[model samples]
Target: FLPLRGILPDMICDSKSYIDLLTIYQEKARKDCELVGNYLYDLLQKYCSKNVSSKAQLDDLVSIYCKNSSFLNVVRTSELKQEYRHENNESLKQYVEQLPAAQQAPSDGDQSESMMTPQPIFAQDCPELCWYIGLRLCDLFHEKYGRYPGEQLKDIQNGSEDDNSREEMDTDQRQIETDLHDLKLIGKQFLTDHELAKHQGGIRDTVLEELCRYGSCEIHSIAAFVGGCCAQEIIKLITHQYIPIDNTFIYNGIKQSTALFKF
Candidate 1:
């Protein structure tokens, strides 16, 4: 049977930056696990259509999976061995600092390495994809501002004691406009850095506006639906009976539909 693994991260300090970095790392690590599961299932379907094969055949499939899906494409050369340690503490520090300085260049390294950087594929027609892209932008906003968009407005309004003065309203509007403009700037910089600026159209303003208004608040209805879905997916994985999501799963509560994105 294929092995299943769970994350047990290394010891981390109690600082907020480190905590935020851990969250991002965990999200990326979870995505990596899903990618491996999907790749393995596809490989099995391709090789063993009817039933499990001989030990030699299974061994070959494992080797092929390793060669194709190993992190960073490290298996491109059989002689290349991956070393994991705390040798890159400086790089980690830069990464944590990058949240506040979105335009900063990545720390120096071997620029010629074969690394996978998924370019932004913004499609105006796909709301799910656009929403996903907006979520990434929201994450960047959090990194830079240490608060989600609209959060400051919420706090200001809360502290106003229902006065609803013109000055307060104008301040809220100005804050929102500033946040939206900054998000757009960061998104553009991200696209340029990833060489995706030449794409036909960038993210739409409406998407950014919606995300700004959201302020990353958790809604109970959406949370309940997502939680149920997660439970079902976990059951599927444990039972090994039905196919789980391939890679990306998007749920649009507005549209009341779910979409699968395989990349």
Candidate 2:
């Protein structure tokens, strides 16, 4: 939607001073186009029409734009390369030549640690609301029973038969109830009286209550579904250039009760 065409030529002229500027423009255009394609695909069902407007139409537009942009970048880069060649900029030519063949290997420790760390469900600036809820529920469980609920819930979700004792089952249920109580507390702290009344017995209310009372086992099946929805929304925000993302917001969900962070 933005008029990138007008600025492209000025930044991409065949000149030594503009080489870096040209590369930056090309990269930004490629990234912006990809983001647009992704956003359209994710929200197509909600906003697009089946008869006239469709994901396919959006995809086609993105493909055409990308193709043209890619061709233009190639041509521009080639021209720059030619200018360098003419000027006998052998150092720059050698650097370019080495780029395609050179590969960097991570240290052994780096590889091992990277493999062990779980991939974040959302972009670095995107908050994992469900996970935040889960962690808060875990803390509430710990307050009541002096132990985290994560281990027990993990066992149940993983279908581990070894921990199927009656005692464990009862403990798990109690933990869920405690989680539900916490959710109510959270809701009361955040929502106005009218807003809370509207959702008193609704699905959202029920889910929040259940999550607080019982932990993820009560909603483990929907964890991935909820996470994916949040990820989709976050992607839309980033791609649309909606706002500058903050890392702290991603780490901590909206704190309703206090202005200051407790931890």
Candidate 3:
């Protein structure tokens, strides 16, 4: 889902000066984001002193950093009390004009191919555990199969299929579309595989057809549900009121099932 793994370094390399600033705050918070942010603000102070002359420009710089920084996803919502206005929680996209102009992505080709600024991981970095593994697999598929999940579905489903299709999509919708496209294709591959016979209930054609029906779906019900749940947990931790769940929540709307497990 995140292009961070295996490709993030190249993205961040688009901003080596800012990337070097990260070295000043690595592994420095319990969440490990606070220290990095402090370091970022310090470097920002120096940069702003020399280059940024206006609050608007400074906001733009900070906003772009918020959108690209690895720590951004961890901090923006939970730490910022965003209350789910956006998922991917890009509370900062409004501020980013482009990846900090301190360094720009190498302009070797068209903007489409150069959209991503890949930042590589470091030795001390903690591994990220995302639930959307299928999406990650699709990224891998792009390397071997020579197509992104979105491109795969694009072959079959016209993205602008709906009347509102021409509508502008925000960053979060774009992110979700990319992931959903991957999920649909990966699910299709899994369904066709004879080895994965244990799982059932997916009528392959019907499932894929349904997915295509909403080819450009940007549904956010799940975002609100998940966001509210997370906000509740954060409040509990801050107010020291009701106890939070121990861990793991498994929700399956299609099966109408829910399970909670604590290890």
TM-score of each: 0.49, 0.25, 0.26
Steric clashes per prediction: 0, 7, 13
- Poorest stretch of ten by lDDT in candidate 2: 254-263
Which candidate order results from sorting by lDDT in descending order?
1, 2, 3
Off by over 4 Å in 3: 1-197, 200-212, 250-263
Against the reference, the lDDT scores of all candidates come to 0.58, 0.43, 0.40
Best by TM-score: 1
lDDT tens string, model 1, 36-141? 6566667667897687454445555554443434232211221111111123233223322222212322445664331111122233233565566567678777
Native-referenced Cα lDDT, model 3: 0.40
lDDT of 1 at 175: 76
TM-score of 1: 0.49
Poorest lDDT segment (10 consecutive residues) of candidate 3: 123-132
lDDT of 3 by residue, 27-82 (tens): 23222333344555667678776763554444555444444554432212243233
Model 2 C-alpha lDDT versus the unseen true structure: 0.43
What's the CA RMSD for each of the models? Answer: 22.6, 24.3, 24.5
Tens digits of per-residue lDDT, candidate 2, 9-94, equal: 64445576687676777787767777778876767756654644655667678856665553342211233334323354343233
